[model samples]
Target: MKLTVKEERCSGCNVCRVVCALHNAGAVQPSQALLKIKGEFPDPGTYKIAYCNQCGICADSCPEDAILERDGEYNIDYELCTQCLICIDSCPFDVMVVTESEYPAKCTGCGKCVELCPRQAVLADQG
Candidate 1:
C-alpha cells in the first residue's frame, strides 16, 4: 500500500503532515512529517503534496544500510542509522523528513492520514 495525494482536493490544510509527525515522532510538528505539503509559489490557495511511495531509494542511499524494507514498506532502523542526513538530500520526491532531534522516517502504510483527512485528499492505493 502507498499514500497518494489529490492536490486538487487539498485545502492547503496540513492534517496529513501533523498526523505523520505524530506517528513518526510522537509530536504534532508538521515539519517532521514524512510527507510534504508545498503551497504554490506566489499563490496562497494552491498546494502540492509529496509522499513516500515506499521506494527503496533512501535505503540504497544509506551508507550505513540503516534504511530497510520490510514486507514492501521502508523505514529507517534508528540503531543502525548514523544521522548522516544523506537520505534527506537523496530523496527523489523530496518528501523524506529527517530532523536534527529525530531519526529518519518513511510511511509505514498505516493509513492514518487517509482515514483522518478532512478533505479526503489522502488516499491509500493498494497498488
Candidate 2:
C-alpha cells in the first residue's frame, strides 16, 4: 500500500505532516514527517504533496539490506543499517529523513494521516 495525495484538494495546512511527524517521531515537527508539502506560489490556494510510494527503491539501494517492507511500509532495520545513506540518494520523492538515530525515517502505514487530513486529500492505494 502506498499513500496518494489529491493535490488540488490540499490546502497546504500541513495537518498531514504534523500527524505523520507526531505518529512516527513523537514530535510535532513537520520535517520529521514521512510526507512532504510544497507550496505552489503561482496558485496560492493549492499545494503539492510528496509521500513514499513504497516502490522499494530505497530498499534495493541498501548495500546492507537494511531497508525492508512489512505491512506495506518500508522501514530501516537499525541493527542491519550501516549508515551509508545510499537510501537517501535513491528516494525519488525525496522524503527519506536523516536524523540523529542514524537511520532514515519511513512511513509506519498507520493510516493516521489519511484519517486526520482535514481536506481528505490523502488516500491509501492498497494494491
Candidate 3:
C-alpha cells in the first residue's frame, strides 16, 4: 500500500504528524514521524506531503540487508541496520530519514497517519 496525500484537504493542523509520531515512536515529535508536512506559511495550497509509498527502493538499497519486505509492507530492522544511510540515499521521495541517534525511519504501512488526519488528507491504499 501507498500513502496518498490530498493537499487541498490539509489544514496545516499537523494532527496527522503528531499522531503518527505518538503512535510509532511513543513521543510527540513530528520529525520522527514517517510522514512529513512541508510548505510555507501564508499559502496553504503550497503545502506538500512527503511519505513512503512502500516501493521497496529503500529495502533494495540497504547494503546491510536491514530493510525487508513482508506482506507488501517494508520495514527496517534496527538490530541489523549498520547506519549505512544507503536507504536514505536511494529514497526517490526523500522520505527516509536517519535521526541523530542513527536510527533509520520509514513508513511501515501502519495506517496510524491515515487514521489521525483530521482532514483525511492522507490515505493508505493499493494505488
Candidate 4:
C-alpha cells in the first residue's frame, strides 16, 4: 500500500501534523508530527504534506540501529534514536522533519494522519 497527498486541498492548517503527533506520540504539537506541511499563504497557498513513502532511507541511514523494518514498513525506535538527523538529510522527499528535540520523525503508516485530515488529502492504496 501507498499514500498520495493532494497539495491543492491542503490548507496548511497542520491538522495532519497535529493528528499524527497525537496518535503516535500522544501529543498535540506539530513538531512531534511525522508529516510536514510546507507552503506560505496569500500566494497560491500550496501546502504539501511531506512524509515517508515507506521507504527505508532512515532505516538504512541510522548508525545506532534506531530505525527498523517490520511488516513491510519502516519504523523508528524513539528510545534508540539519538536525534542525529541523518535520516532526515537522507530522505529525498524531505518528508522527515526535525523535531524540537532534534530527532527526525517520518510517517509511521498508521493511517492516523489520513483519518484526521479534513480535506482527505492523504490516500491509502493497495496494489
Greater-lDDT candidate between 1 and 2: 2
Q: Which residue runs does candidate 4 get wrong by more than 4 Å?
A: 78-85, 97-104
Question: Which candidate wins on lDDT?
Answer: 2
Tell me the lDDT of candidate 4. 0.77
The per-residue C-alpha lDDT of model 1 at residue 104 equals: 70
As for candidate 1, its clashing pairs are none
Residue-wise lDDT of candidate 2 within 12-47, one digit each (tens)? 888988988888888878888888988978856568
- Model 1 score (lDDT): 0.82
Model 1 alpha-carbon drift over 4 Å, by segment: 41-45, 100-102
* Candidate 3: segments with Cα more than 4 A from true spot: 40-44
Structural similarity to truth (TM-score) of each candidate: 0.85, 0.89, 0.85, 0.75
Clashes of each: 0, 0, 0, 0
Q: Per-residue lDDT for 9 in model 4?
A: 83
Q: What lDDT would candidate 3 get against the real structure?
A: 0.81
Candidate 3 residue lDDT tens string, 1-127:
5688888787778888788778777887887777778776776457788788888988889888888888888889999998888888899888776775878888878788788788888987755
Q: List model 4 lDDT by residue over 66-94, tens digit each.
A: 88888768878989998878888888877
Better of 2 and 4 by TM-score: 2
lDDT of 2: 0.84
Regarding TM-score, does 2 or 3 come out ahead?
A: 2
Query: Which model scores highest in TM-score?
Result: 2
Between 1 and 3, whose lDDT is larger? 1
Better-scoring candidate (TM-score), 1 or 2? 2
